[model samples]
Target: MAWEQVQKALKDHLGDSIYNLWIDPLECVSYRADEVRLACPDRFYRAHLDRNHLATVQQIVTELSGNDCKVILCDKETAILPAAQPKGQLRLPHIPERKSVVRALHPRYTFDAFMLGESNLLAQSACKSMINGDDTVGSCLYINSSTGLGKSHLTHAVAHALLADSPQTRLRYVTAQQFASEMVRSIQSRSMDTFKSVYHDHCDFLLVEDIHSLQGKKKTQEEMNELLDALIKSGKRVILTANNAPRDLKGIDNEFRSRMGAGLVTTIQAPDLATRYRIVEHKAVQSGLNLEEDVISYISQQIQGDVRRIESALLSLSAKATLAGGAVEMDMVRDVVAEIVGLSTNLTTTLIGEIISREFNVSYKDLQSRSRKKVISFPRQVAMYLGRKHTEESLGEIGKVFNRNHATVLHAVKVVSELCRCDTSVRRQMEILDRKMAEM
Candidate 1:
């Protein structure tokens, strides 16, 4: 069978999500009798497929070609680095090269519009400095946090602020997925020169969101690495957002991850209960609806983590009230809460430990172990606090999960509570971790 047929067969066997995130980035560069060579964009992709999917690929190749075939996977040669293009007037091909436009900025996501709580105060300040011409913050700033935490909002606000100050400032904002798709298209069209020219020559400031989404696309990863190097070398500003920290990112190249970490790295924590209440009220006013205090309080308690979910609940209640021809009361709010909160499954302490561990880059074993090290001890305290807050587990029950006495759990809970009141950073960390556990 033809290589195209094999490709189609594999894509059909694996679903779109798996294929696109993993297999679609591969290029079958050469083939011989019973042996096929696949060129991947980077070493990480080659290792990933070799470990997880190569056996299945071999099976598919055998079924397709009616013979046992050997699959050799390796990184694509860097010799295709666009120096071969003849120096002269450019020629337009019959088919146009693919391109993606940056997503439009949300008008509501201005700096003044963003609600400032302790959770996002630092991030907000950093972003303001960037807008105010503080180039000392380094050319690359990485902002990472769980979903609905305001990374996107901050980036959008930065764009608006920059443009407001100087409309002629050239900026481009795209999700990591868009950049990866464009990279794939450029490879297909053999027009990488055009891709490099667009990013290096056109963008004065570039912001990419959800960069964690570019996990398995090594070519796109390499392309982004190059783009970042060029932009930073030329003193152009670049900002990137992801769900997790650079050190926690799996399947990304080490050199690229180091570059991401070399600059300022900041996280947006989940909002605390009071902050959630404020958010509901803020969003309520923005939606032009008046919500009762009791109703807002009820939502503040029920919707655990995601501000987006809180906004969604408010929208639903507002819509329902409009349809029912009545004000939003506690009963209506309870109904909305049930509808929204019921969708989330109950969380487990084991899961909570995992999320906190990943967020702090502490090992799960260390978290549960009896270690008095400040780093491990504090995360353990936060875990204990989260356990009491998010789960139905009693203090003694939670103690069993952490291999401690009930009094120990209680002490941990107290310490974290006090720290939350005193340390803004600790408070924000708990807020973000609690939501991630509850949402998970």
Candidate 2:
């Protein structure tokens, strides 16, 4: 049960290969009467530890008759991870009194990294100005845009700017749903004081992404209202980003809606061809691809609509060409485009069969079969969502590909789309998968 004993057991059994592979990088995050905590430095570490190291540690504890043990891997970038002190302990540090330390800041998204133009210049300027004492003190700035138009980037940039002194600023950023869950935890633990202080009074700024996540949680909205009032009264600024503005947060109270709208509100419409081309150029530079003007325009026009989709297309195309030790050309780009938008990737029958199988979690024969079950229904819809989310194909076209009616395809897309929006686990999984599909 002692810290030294745990360390010795791990060192004795885990050996250099497994220890370095699984345990060495983690910090002994905490230990209370019934639980011990471990913290890893990044997502890769957390994934490996959770998959491989967790069982070994649990077995060791069970052998020694230790208290019920659990391993929680915290994202070091977020407030989720506890900082370790020297001497095998972690401090339960309160969110600091000074408002300079914040998590939820994506270091890759500074003003310098954001691809800005007319669409986001004002919002970007406000973000850049905030750290320099140029506070945009409005009730809230409402930024709404179609997915992948840099709203998340701008939100993180603002948080990073405000927390110019990393250790001193105590900013708390979360989706509205996470805000709700944390509020419940605060109430149960009788630590609402720390929760409110961390989320409200201790921070000079609050940034909430995906305000739509708050659509149905009334009790959480009430808690947020209190936090909002305390923050505004204290002259702190709050930044909110969502798919829609305050007036559209379904099921929210009217007064709370007004409170959100008391400041500047802006909506970013979907990109035009010109904006999409600019995005493709920016993306080409980001990806180290020297795209010709014609190539950029070709991709921009083809991908259309969401800037994120266009960039994704471009990055994936360029990555594929580079990996094959070939130059990026119209032909290379055209092949990728055809497959995603049509049936033109030169995929061998075996590879094409493999992809279809993975997409729907059905064997090629099963997909060809006539089974009607929840398992198939689920992955079929997931494949439809992928076709809709990742490719520029028409619904009818996607239906033909899946050998289903257009209406059925549309229904699958709708159900999966809604699930991705409300279901966090599904949302994260699809995001990762969508990224992978584009790369392929």
Candidate 3:
């Protein structure tokens, strides 16, 4: 039988925990009716298999291959660095040694601390179920969102939750860049086996952050593919976070992409206004800054669609208030926002929509509504086009304001751009809108 099939049967036979710790790391080197050779990463793995699981593994191989195949062990060449050093030495030069196995779990990123919103409700719920030990949630999950949308925060929360739930549960949380860097280091030191053992054998729950970082790295993607396959076959839990959906990742390996997609995929969308307000409030409270409702609302309005920026703004405001020895007020908040985000005025999609609606003699609600009437549609399209041109909001953000999709926003921009190029009247009107917005 194929190693993949053998891997599945072994998981069924040995169960998840046992198979993951012992048998999962073993790579089939060569197999025949009379003999089979398995590759182990290090002396420890070979010794463990030899002392405990050799007989069981041999029997399973015999049953699967339909012949009594002698299981022989071969240890792969190993060294974590360029040269073998003492046992307690650090392997990589740049990376500092940490006492904990799962590094990068921030102290503040706990489940209770995360502000639940419509954007991240389902993703948070799924993470919570896994944390609460719900087997129905499955062993693999993919959390995808753009930058500043709290993908990293949620993954760290998962780590904290798992550790809290079971103190002894083995886990390793690393970014895709870290994983890829380690793989490159392993290749340089000829310790690929040790790398495999570290991830596939030592880890029970692997939470890899920023997996989109592996998109263009060919060798790293291959290594990750193998590691993922081994972990999945052994029934180990793997949580991956990325900036984009699996299929949307450009230049990633096809097989690796498929493996990434073979799990529950959930996205954290951009938070709505109310959600942003809650986030600002939560972050302010965490920072020990008592923000008034108006300040919170102002911060939320200014730092829309990005939780990180909201927290940053709150932190800056808190620091400025502390320095001034006074309470935070609207002017102070405005100055801090200007310093942090470089704002000229309160320019937002809503303001842009209002301006365009008034100019075209249409209600702002009608412009934001689902009305496809030419009178309302032209102004709405103009609003979308100008929103994209003037603001830092994403196409999705502009679409949300106009009740349309990014594709629709792009179409609007294209249509408006063509109109500006061909028609002098439309060009002058667009110039007027631009000047008015700049003045605002």
Candidate 4:
């Protein structure tokens, strides 16, 4: 009975193709005197419905009711549906089942939780469209932002939304290193076929965190290329996050770069003072701490780093106050992060070694104990390379950490440099490691 008159109007006016595609799928939600809320499953559907057929929809309603009536797409949100396919029906598709790298989904990344400021509207719509499965939008979604822009949260939100609606949807969220590590293990185990099947053929969607890590590794580039092409060809969606654009992913394949650029690209710009305050207040509320607006404003104004540090300062103040059984006042924030503002310090020797060990097979002990073997030295060279990249320490000081002269440190940098140009595997490893260190 809801759209009875409207239906008659539509039948009288629009042809069948436009009717079926545009109006057929819309579901009516609650309505008020001012608005008749209609919603399509995804934004693409909404855009299509609105673009080609809004006039017809409006005309139908106006004629049927003898007054103006309108339609609006429901929120671009998909409800998680039960995923149990009939026996033998939706059995896990033959995609690769690499060990999932989604350590945890952010509780705040859902549509209900995200602060819907105007800045992120386009991206939100794109995410909603991709989640809704219109297929017009390219599968490769690029979220560009500097540190602390909540890119990861948005990425996770898309992953959660899609898999929620279609539980049978094959989804894996991972950092680039984890992707490489899984691939490396697959190659080692001679189950590259399974890896290939799981990662490329079987995956319905892949949300890769920090794809800039793919910049250098030729092997990772090729492996990623094959996986991307497979997914792209099969109509699977991929979401990628990075600190910079595809062009900035040094050493990445031009073809892959071209493909990434083909999709929707959006950036999370640095938050304004108001946004930063909102972030502070949000973090403070989670900790059951409250600060005065003036104080929140001051703390937000003082900080210039990513969202990570802003939250950290909030937590630090809360912890300090909690230990003293006090409040997270502005004075407390000021006292805690005073030194953290506009200050960049050298990467400590220990942190540098751990980064090296994680990147290369070299042990932390080997980093300082003078290992010249290819395996050990390769990691050591990586450590030196990162040191040059991320610290105030001079090359001579870095040499001291490695028990080598400055010239040797320079050589290590050069050696990795030359290897990165030709060896895809080596390049991928270094890039991932470098990003890891930078994030830390």
Candidate 5:
């Protein structure tokens, strides 16, 4: 009952996502008035817990047990070892044999490592359903999103879970380009049957990434269509990811697109502000960085959309702190944020206008023109919106860059904000521009 109480307290304090990722997997070895023991999944999990969570566990245990209780955390293997083993005997943890994979899966890309948010909850849930053999999700799933939005992460997670749960599962994970190249090699060597046989007969689960690359390749498309047909007929599970939806993909045949869209089609949107905060916190803890709350909030606010940018910023922060005698201050964080977002000192309204003009294919001078043409006016509005976001300029100051008034700049920001909420295409373009600005 005390253990249950501790679990409830942890869930309440740390929130569901963090609790599920770290604490929920832990097994209770024993509990007593003065001592409690917990078993972690492995050395990696145990080390992380000891570094980040052990003190919290000890405090909670002491309060619940009404004594100065000591908490012992060890790997599952050590917890389950024979009681007769000699005292202080060294034992190496047993490691499972690695499963064969076409491309090595990242060890940290498993489902537990994925941060759930409003933008990606559906995609994550659907992947979990497919892996759990829930019939509602069907046998095929397609996830589409822009770069660095966790498309590959989810696919790798599915593969990792499958092989771990069912080691004998004949899984084939490859990119669309890799699949096309292998097919070409098979044809060149006059051994197409062997290639077909490998996917058709030997595979139980198939994962293909970046199906957008298969566009305009008719022969590859034909072979892929036939392969999908065979795999589906045999009730094999398949997952494919791309940067575009099936119907939106260019140069892809209708039948092949139909197959891709047959089961479930999900898209991952950019993380919202709250989700971005959680991501920043989670990454900082994982990297063993003792960043202050204000630092985390600042990074989350500045770095939008891409998860990779956050990682890069944190890594840079860590290096800088180490060089400066391990002190992280607000000024250091500001410099890191500016560097990651590609702002030299600050992002000027002029630079924002130029980037928008180039992206919208309108001349920079035209943006400052009085023309009401949709092409010219739309880009000007976007520039105004971005200027308000990336610079400390007032609305009037931002409007001066476009030869417009503060009222016009404010209206542009409002209109573009609403459009980003209602229109997927608009939101996607903004995400692209956001990335471009960060990389500039």
Candidate 6:
């Protein structure tokens, strides 16, 4: 009861985001007159709370209890120790058991390494909720996204977190193709009972990637549907990833689609400009390349979708810089961008205007017109801003394309730049436009 009061106070004081991210995961093991004990998920979690939040927690507990209350923080494993035991006698932490994953997970795909952004925040948060064993997220989670947008990364992170927190957790991570192949092999060998038992009885957590691949396989779909029903009924956790939402998946039966969509379904869109910038910076640092801010900006702008492309471009730049025995420069970045993005070196103001017109649904004539309405002028400003960034055209030349003066072009650029900083909606629009142009 006292812990509930402390939780309320902490939520009110720290706000929902911070409280949910840091405090909500902690479990209150016991509360006595003079002492309160809380169990953290792991050592890393306990250490972070001890360093940053323990004092506040102690203060809050003391105030809530109307007495001097000592707050003890321990890992979940040690939470069962008797309160009379000395701190020195606490059990030593053990290494987390390695998970038996079907496919090897990338070493760097853990939660700490995933970049957070407006686009992928919900997907990441849902995955975290699953990891924390928060019941509110349901027993299943479906993540759908285009390639290279971090679905696999989040799934791998979930596996890492689940195994770390609960070593004996039966986690089976595999692609849909792998699942189907195993089923076929079992059928041929007359071991179908064993196959079904492994997924339905032995598994505690099931992670199947690219379920879209099972679109037309009727038997696999039926088997998967039955497996999902079994897992969900038994309260097992399931995470499924695909390139399309369940409703949009073709050749999948209504029953199977319904099962996939039964839980929280979240989509990860292309990262916005700010997210891409952070991704570029983080990857560059990991590669030990000292890229100038301008070079980073250029890469982030030129490469829009598919974070893997960013990594590839960085690798190419690093290799080129090493061969030349010099630091990375804008020219090297441009060549890499040109090679990977297939962007023509001759991007013109006219092409930029056309792309903006298509994106905003404003006619090219309206964009170049004297209209001052928000709809028309807003798109015009965005075009001018993009023109300056993507093209080597001078302000005067860009202005002529929009039927405006150099001063007007400069003002438009300034306004759009400020909007990109202060307005998320505008920043998202810019990112979409940037991706569209890059795809061209």
Off by over 4 Å in 4: 1-101, 342-440
Model 1 bad stretches (over 4 Å): 1-101, 343-440
lDDT of 4 at 250: 82
Give the Å error, residue 432, model 6: 22
Model 3: lDDT to the true structure: 0.78
Candidate 4: RMSD to truth: 21.0
Model 5: runs farther than 4 Å from truth? 1-100, 344-440
lDDT of 1 by residue, 1-440 (tens): 34665566567666688888888888877665468888888998789989988876776665434345788887897412212545765535532222223478888988887878657888888888766658767778899899998998999999888777845456777899878876676567454554565687657788899889878777778888889999889888889999999999988988888877878898898775556767888899887778887666557656867788888888898899899885777677777888888844467665566556656768667887889999898888888888888888898988887788899999999999999999999888777766656444
Return the lDDT, model 5, position 43: 98
Instruction: Report lDDT (CA) for all predictions.
Output: 0.76, 0.65, 0.78, 0.69, 0.82, 0.83
Candidate 1, run of 10 with poorest lDDT: 93-102
The TM-score of candidate 1 is: 0.58
Candidate 2, residues 1-440: lDDT per residue as tens digits? 34444555666666778876667766765654456677778888788778876776765543332235664566556524444545943435553333233344667777777766556777776665554545553545668877877888887777766566544545666677767876786577454544554555446667788887787778887888888888887777777788877877788888778878877788776554455666778778878888887687556545644566565676688779789785887788877766556644332222333354554446544543456777666776676667766667677776666577779878987898898889999898778766645544
| Candidate 2 Cα deviation (angstroms), residue 261 | 0.4
Candidate 5 per-residue lDDT over residues 278-339, each given as its tens digit? 78999988887898987886687678788999999999999999999989998998899889
Record all residue pairs in model 2 with backbone atoms less than 3 Å apart, i.e. clashing.
99-169, 100-168, 100-169, 101-168, 101-169
Report the C-alpha lDDT of model 3 over 4-110, residue by residue, as the tens digit. Answer: 65676667666799999988888776755577778898998899889988876775565444345698887866322223433864446443222125665689888
Measured with C-alpha atoms, the lDDT of residue 371 in candidate 3 is 85
- From the highest lDDT down, the ranking of the candidates is 6, 5, 3, 1, 4, 2
**lDDT, model 6:** 0.83
Task: Report RMSD for candidate 3.
Answer: 15.2
Ranking by TM-score: 6, 3, 1, 5, 2, 4
Candidate 4 or 2, higher lDDT: 4
